[model samples]
Target: MNAVTRLLRDLVAIPSVNPRLLGPDVETPAEEPVAEYLSVLAKKHGLDVSRQAVLPGRRNLLVRLKPSGKVKKRILLAPHMDVVPADDSQFKPSISNGRLYGRGACDTKGCIAAYFHALCQIAKYKQRLQHTEIIFLGLIDEEHLQSGSRAYARNGPKADLAIVGEPTRLQIITAHKGDFWWQLKVVGKAAHGATPHLGKSAVHQMARTVEILLTEYNDSLKEKQHPLLGSPTINIGVIQGGTQPNIVPDTCSIDIDRRTLPGETENTVRKEILDVLKPHGLKPDFLDLRGVPCDALETNPALPLVQRFMKVARRRRTLGADFFTDASPLASAGIPAILYGPGDIAQAHTSEEWIDLTQLEQATEVVKRFLQEVES
Candidate 1:
């Protein structure tokens, strides 16, 4: 097996499931094992390594390749370390049909392996990198709260450009949608089952609120569309109301997952919802489920570095991703970021997650070449 494929297999074999995905009493190392493994590997290669404490036991690992000469430009290679909850069998990685199968195989671990392989290859000619410094950041808690990236953004150095890695089929992604979660609750007086007219039904009012959001509010969102990301989207994932069939529901609530495009803010979105609901005399309580909104990423494709990277990847046009990534937080911190990596996102978070070996090798080579070019 090639070096990149071997590294990916080893990584998959180590279970680094996000702690939030597990039960409270469940004993798991979370991302510690993977962070230690990468730390040892970095030290073996004589690279600078450090850790950024994110949570009580979780930390983000940093492996750096400093230039021999003065540092003029800084490039960050960021790939998340945490994976979604998986069965024990999924942790034992296996290779078959030119694919590596395991948890986080395509979701992100492939990106971590490919980026590390490329960094190691570039370390051979350190003298050539006179002015550019490359850093490999293994972020934690990306599957849950994204605390790792948030901590790095607040404490990490300012980077000229950041290459956020994910399963993108090796495409250069310049834009992606953001996620905003909210819960709307409608309140009403409880009434007896027999006398339904005595007290108002909150569930019935919530039904109207949901209808407006699904129809009129949804249609309005379609009118404002982003070229690459398309239109914003809203999904009523959950609804809770009433205790029993007879008792009138005093309170009804719905959890909403709104995918926001560029230029869309929490205030604007809330205002839009209010505008639609107020006309119908419906004023539900609004609560921000996600304390901090995940903003959309829209890096200028015209930047010199971006253009050069696209040229290296041999892509004439940039693409957009519907899902959010660590790129947004870094970008919001003033660093231009983009997503690129091997494998398909369809295989992410699946029962049988796997990555294509051919794409993995290609991604390593592409990243290596890009780093060399940036150095020169």
Candidate 2:
């Protein structure tokens, strides 16, 4: 097997499922194993490695390769190490018809394999490069709240440009929609189900709120559309209230997902939500909680690094993704970042996830070429 294939197989075989998807019975629930594995691989390749602990027993691993001459630019290869939960059988990677099947085989492990191989080759040919710094960051909790990337962006050691590892079918992504979430809660008096008139129902009030969001808010969002990203959108993901059918619930809470466009911030979204609530008499108390807030990415196509990557990869089209990525946080921190990798985003988080070996090879070649091009 090739080095990239072997690396991907090893990564797939190890169960580094995100803790949020599992119960408390798991002994090791974070990306510690995968982080350590990549760390050892970097050391084996004679590179400098370090870790920034994001959570207890979980860390974001960074491996670096320094050039011989003065560094002109720094490029980061960021791929999340954590995968969504999977069954025990899924942990054992199996190859069939030139495809590797496993939980994270396509989502990002394929990028890890491709990036690592290219990094190894670049380090081997370090003397050929004039000036450039290459870094591979194996981030944790990307499938969750992206806390790893958040911490990395907030803390020290920033980069000039970055290639965030996500399944883009080997395409160069210049823009993608933003992801933000809020929790709406309605509190009311509780009473017996038989005497419904004695107390108000929070669920009823919440239903009206949901209708307003589903209709007015979404309609208003459609008017403000992004060029690459179609329109700002919202989805009611989860709703929980009431203990049983026989009792009036005192509280109803729902999670709302808002996909924002460029020029939108947490405060802006908050105000928009409040405006939607005001007409219906719903107060700010309804939207009292917020989830991991991230911005949409809109990199200038004329930027040197972006143009170099597109020219090196030989891809013509510039597109946007409906999903979110770690690039948003990095870009918010003043670093030019784009999403590019092997495989398709469709296979991510699927039950029988797999990545095409052909695409993987193509992506590997692209990474090598981009690194050399940017460095030169």
lDDT per residue, candidate 2, 1-376, as tens digits?
7878889999998888889667667657578888888888888878899989888788898898887788777889998898998888888999999999998998899999999889888777654455678889889989877888888889937788889999999888889888677787889889999998998889988888889889988899889977888989999999888898989988998888888887888788878988988988886354534346678998887888888888888977678898889988888888888999999999898888999988888889998888877755
Error of 1 at 196 (Å): 2.4
Worst 10 residues of 1 by lDDT: 121-130
Question: Which candidate wins on lDDT?
Answer: 1
Scored against the true structure, residue 120 in model 2 reaches a CA lDDT of: 87
Q: TM per model?
A: 0.98, 0.92
lDDT of each: 0.92, 0.85
Question: Residue 46 in model 1: shift from native, Å?
Answer: 0.9
Give the clashing residue pairs of candidate 1, or none.
Answer: none
**Regions of candidate 1 where Cα sits further than 4 Å from its true position:** none
Q: How many clashes in candidate 1?
A: 0
lDDT of 1: 0.92
